[model samples]
Target: MELEVRNLSVSRGGVPVLEGLSFRLAPGRALILRGPNGIGKTTLLRTVAGLQPPLSGEVGLDREAMAYAAHADGIKATLTVAENLSFWAQVFGTGDITPAIDGFALDELRNRPAGGLSAGQKRRLGLARLLVTGRPVWVLDEPTVSLDVDAVAMFGAAVRRHLATGGMALIATHIDLGLDEAEVMDVGPFKAKPPKVEDFDEVFL
Candidate 1:
């Protein structure tokens, strides 16, 4: 499978942040997004995930084939670790969560309440949810946040396995996650230029 974007423009709060962005990612590969803060990396990923509309152009891919992981962990504090995974497994119509649990080394904490897990553990749990989705395309936002070195390694291993199985990922991260063959896309050049002086003044006047 391949994801193609044609001259896509994305915005937040009706203000454009990225423009003229286009790229195609084939299966068994990963594309890393790089840029300074507020340069629209998250906005681009969100738009691609269909969480928000792109200001222009198109995203060519099957929505059903993509799984999106936002910046937040999306965990239920009251539930146990295994329970949280179970809930998502059911939502994604997957029955076996063994791989997700093993992939993240979450077996020991399986019975613990999510509320009690440390920040890194919670992050791992959130990432593990992705495995159970069974979708081929993963769109992730800063997936390594709060993860320790070992956890990051585990995450990298998981991503490698996904690619090995012919899946692809589009990741936005500040630090390296050791994706050897992943292509890097610097979003800097695609940042939307500021409005003209008169146009900017007109909005406030």
Candidate 2:
């Protein structure tokens, strides 16, 4: 599977987040998106996932090839970890999450409601959903957020395994994910934001 971003631009409330950012990924490879806070990392990831629109560019993916894990855990707070996995698996038509859950050592938390799980556990559950997706191209946003060092290491191992099996991932993270020979795309050079106090926040006040 292949994914290419062509001159992608993103703007919110007339504020430009990304400009002319572009890249390509081939099968069995991974790319890491790097930038400081509020530098459009989440915005770009959302654009790739089709969750949001690109302000002035396009995102193209090969036919039948895509998946995403958002910065915020996509797991439903009301559902148990297992239930969430089951729902996504049936919807996406792929492997069950029990194996993934076991890999992440999440089996014990499977019966717990997502809302009751800790932050790290929720992220793990989010990762588990990807195993259910079974898509060739994956876009992950801050995938290790809220995870401890060891859990982060575990997630990296999972990503390596996926790539070894010919799957590709686009990961946005402040910490290294330990992927094999991953290319680093520096988005920091694109930061274009003013401090909140620099905004006109008194329009109606």
Candidate 3:
């Protein structure tokens, strides 16, 4: 499986943010997006995931082959840890979640409600959903947000396992998640330039 971005452009709230960005990710590889805040890392991910339309150009990939995990944990607070994982597994047409359970060290908390988990625990559960997706491509936004050092290590190992199985990942994060093999792309250079002083003033006309 592969992902191709050709001259892609993205905008937020009618303001162009990133432009002319292109990249390709082959199987068993990862691409880490690095940039300052509000540079459209998340926008680019959402665009590629097909959650939102790009301002221009194209992203070539089967939507079904990619699993998107936004910055939010996206867990139902009322559901138990096991229940949350099970729900996603069923949705993905898989009856087995043992690997995801063990991968994120959620065995002991399986019966615990998601509401009772700490911020870090909730983040872990959110990431575990990727395992249930069974998709070859993973798109994660700031996946390491609330995770501690040890949990970050676990996340890294899980990502490594996914890559070993011919899966690829596109991640946007500030801190290092310890994915040494993943190629890096700085979004700064891709940011769209601001309008000229006269052009900006003319917009009020």
Q: Which is the leading candidate under TM-score?
A: 1
* Global lDDT scores for all candidate models: 0.94, 0.81, 0.92
What is the Cα-based lDDT of residue 23 in candidate 3? 96
Q: Please give each candidate's TM-score.
A: 0.96, 0.85, 0.95
**Model 1 lDDT tens row, 63-120:** 7888999879899999999999999999999978999999999999999999999999
Collision pairs in model 3: none
TM-score of 3: 0.95
Best candidate according to lDDT = 1
Give each model's clash number: 0, 0, 0
Candidate 1 lDDT for residue 73: 84
Residue-wise C-alpha lDDT for candidate 2, range 84-147, written one tens digit per residue? 8999889998747777787688988878989999888888888878787888888888888789
lDDT for residue 147 in candidate 3, whole number 0-100: 92
Worst 10 residues of 1 by lDDT: 194-203
| Residue-pair clash count for candidate 2 | 0
The all-Cα superposition gives candidate 1 an RMSD in Å to the true structure of: 1.5
Candidate with the larger TM-score of 1 and 3: 1
